[model samples]
Target: MTRTSQVVVIGGGQSGLAAGYHLRRLGLDFVILDAQTTAGGAWQHTWDSLHLFSPAAYSSLPGRLMPPQAGQEYPDAQHVVEYLADYEKRYELPIERPVRVLGVHRDGGLLRVETDSGPWRARAVISATGTWWRPFLPAVPGRGDFGGRQLHTVDYRSPKCFTGRRVIVVGGGNSGAQIAADLAHDPEVTWVTQRPPRYLDDEVDGRALFDAATARRRALDAGRTDTGGVASLGDIVAVPSVREARDRGLLKASPMFTRLVPGGVEWADGTRAVADAVIWCTGFRPALSHLAPLQLRGRRGRIATAGTRAADEPRLHLLGYGDWTGPASATLIGAGRPARDAAREIADVLA
Candidate 1:
């Protein structure tokens, strides 16, 4: 069946919902196509004990404030999932689930969104698919030869299963740090990072980190050369569990290993450590496979975007792909601006 709309938002996650909110406010005829059968986007797949670095107030989408969980300091993944589901229900956003978009191709004056269900002809398409689907694992020598189990963060559920096992957690990002901390109480776990892990002060959490990033962005936009007090968000925040782990001296990270050997990893100094399993905390690439038909990806495999709109394709906008799409678009709080702006642009064009 062929369907049509003034705008077709290609995801039903936080970013897509934010954009839909604005589009509805503008009275635009639109639909949101979500690949997942349920709500919550990638938060559904995160580890069992995963919690947001920021508190509920700082981690909310536009229009509605995420309510704080009773007696909980930091909202966990399940809390986020329930909130997302409730948000969709509260706003009455038009969402089509389990409709996996296969590809997007230009169709004369309109854009054709080819999906498993059918093709959607839209005046504009918003590609809000986030990075969860595209997990990135760096190629290490003898990776295939390693007889032990290896799993990326996407497949990770809990550290309970890894009891009494020696595991190597690779990457220095928040996920790496959090996962390492989660496993600290269990069997031996080693964290490997290319550089030393920067531990932010106790008071500084995701909110402070985001504020610093916003300041730096503003400074750069104003063409200022000096950003003295700005700190990168790459540093690990002192979350409660992480802080506890640090107190236990379990937050110590080691230098990255050279290659994967049978049953374990080999370091640069010609030393090998035997391991029962390896958990790759490596991050993800943007989930842009469906957009490949557009041929818009530039250097570093990212789409060349002007604000949220595609630089080459004016009728297309991308959201929640990280800083490249818009500052903090990947976060719950940050996605609103870009989404609002994208919807406005699309509405203007359709007008």
Candidate 2:
């Protein structure tokens, strides 16, 4: 086994797999490091009932086609995992699974990556480890005090779990909206958010959001970072899920309560809402502790993502950044642009 691979890609999820496949097609010697025992990244963490809003046709990696599912919506997380397994088998990419990367440090002109299983050296490193690293929940004053099994959207699995519970889902992003809609159908769910997302409707096609993402990427490539953000003015008019919640009266268009008191949460408007559970739909921040030495500049833990996909960190390349990656870079339909470009950039450095 060659200890020194020319390139090392960290992660085995969709983006990492895509990057690895692109490197293979480019004829670059590389290895993919994944922390999970499986290939799918967040898919493994997503709730069981989840299915991608995007259809299967556009979800394939650049070279591989998602096996056709004529009338089905995009495959669920398990299906994605199965597809990934097939992809790894079909491509024969060198992937070391369950290899938790502890630290990535430069040693003697080589990048040394220490993992739980072992160590590897490479000339280039691509952190394709998608953006779902950390689950963000705003610190409520008495969150622990009134706790009735609180969890982030990251830990949420199915509406069935909240079937008989008075659930309060927080946050206004895509995940929160979808989860709220799903839970609303259970007759025991009600949602409140601090700020309503200016969410775009999930049209039959997600092209608008995707295209906006592309434009945002262009701006980033041109050295812009503050251009794209909540597109709405405290209103979620575009999202199908959000709309459904509204239609069902399950969603309350109000800011989150000021604090989570001993028995319930206090809304901003001085209304007290009590519930058996509070689901923090709060967004996430990038957990890049492994890249501590990179000195990435950005508010919170989010690096100032810029360029083609903005997943291009100065010291690393991230593939599955959030919706900001643009139309062609955000979804399975468009993530290749960044992977290929990042591959070339890595190639240039390691050449």
Candidate 3:
């Protein structure tokens, strides 16, 4: 007989782990399937020097509070990872680590999840993995012809390697800003973007955005719906990054890439330049390729999840994903309510 779990939480990051903890707290039988060797999804992959802008207060998981801090500054990458690990241990969460999930589909009244390890059967599935897999690389003509090594911001780990190269970081998002700042340490670095970035307040406590998303979700839950969502910019809000970079003479605004020649880049301003390396910090898409055969709501890989999607398919909900044109669904702290809501739904399903 094939054993089944009440809920299968995918990915072991903040969302996934949070769901696991909540499920256990509600006395539900759930399993957390993580692809990485351990928790701390993006934090572990981020560069060594990267630090969160969100204060430690807002970054806490379900059971444990983040270590005391002097102020509202963000936590370092390692500290975030350590906190997550402690959460799993404190809650006694059952997480199957390094289990690479291929996809999830409905099969005979059960959510059949295919993974590298084996088949998993569950009543509901929570896709806690965020939108970080598909690095959004804008199509540039002859992009492959360039001689220099091309890598996305995801692959970047440190600036020591690019100590002498004229590195160019594309896109105006936080990743681009951080990468450009890292490259700024090298005098040979040049920053470029398609447009000037939108700068919000430097001290963007994600708690407010989280509350806004919760309110919008509650509004949708009620009969009166506005059909909108909210977003969070991690610990690195847009305003601080843009302002900090500008203060250091490191902000550039214009159409960045027009074409890629054999050994040079063609900018939209009709300027031709060659760089030793180009890091595309453009952004990422909802990484649902592994989740084949699921009826997603968008042409892109994203699942069209809203207030209803969460309620109806609580067992199989999407979190930390951009709402596209919607208000602000793509955020970290905003995921708390969804995580708890999904946990409650799964508990009911098991009952």
Per-residue accuracy of model 3 over 1-351 as CA lDDT, tens digit each: 344787787888877877787778888878888888976777788876676656777767656668844543667778888887887888888988899888887887788888888888998888877776667788888788988878987799998888777777777767777777666657667777766565545555466666665666567657676635333333235434455666777665446778877776887677877788888887887777766666554555455555314433444766556543122444444445667766776666667
* Candidate 2, 6-66: lDDT as tens digits: 8888888888888888899888999998988877777788876666656676677878887
| C-alpha root-mean-square deviation, each candidate | 1.6, 3.4, 3.5
Runs in model 3 lying further than 4 Å from the true structure: 69-72, 211-244, 306-315, 323-331
Model 2 CA RMSD to the hidden true structure, in angstroms: 3.4
lDDT of 2 at 15: 80
Candidate ordering by lDDT (highest first): 1, 2, 3
lDDT of 2 at 13: 84
Quote the lDDT for 152 in model 1: 96
Compose the digit string of candidate 1's lDDT tens values, residues 13-126.
899999988998999999999999999888998999899888998888888989998878889989989999999899899999989999999999999999999999999999
Native-to-model Cα distance after best TM-score fit, residue 28 in candidate 1, in Å: 0.6
Residue 264, model 2, lDDT = 73
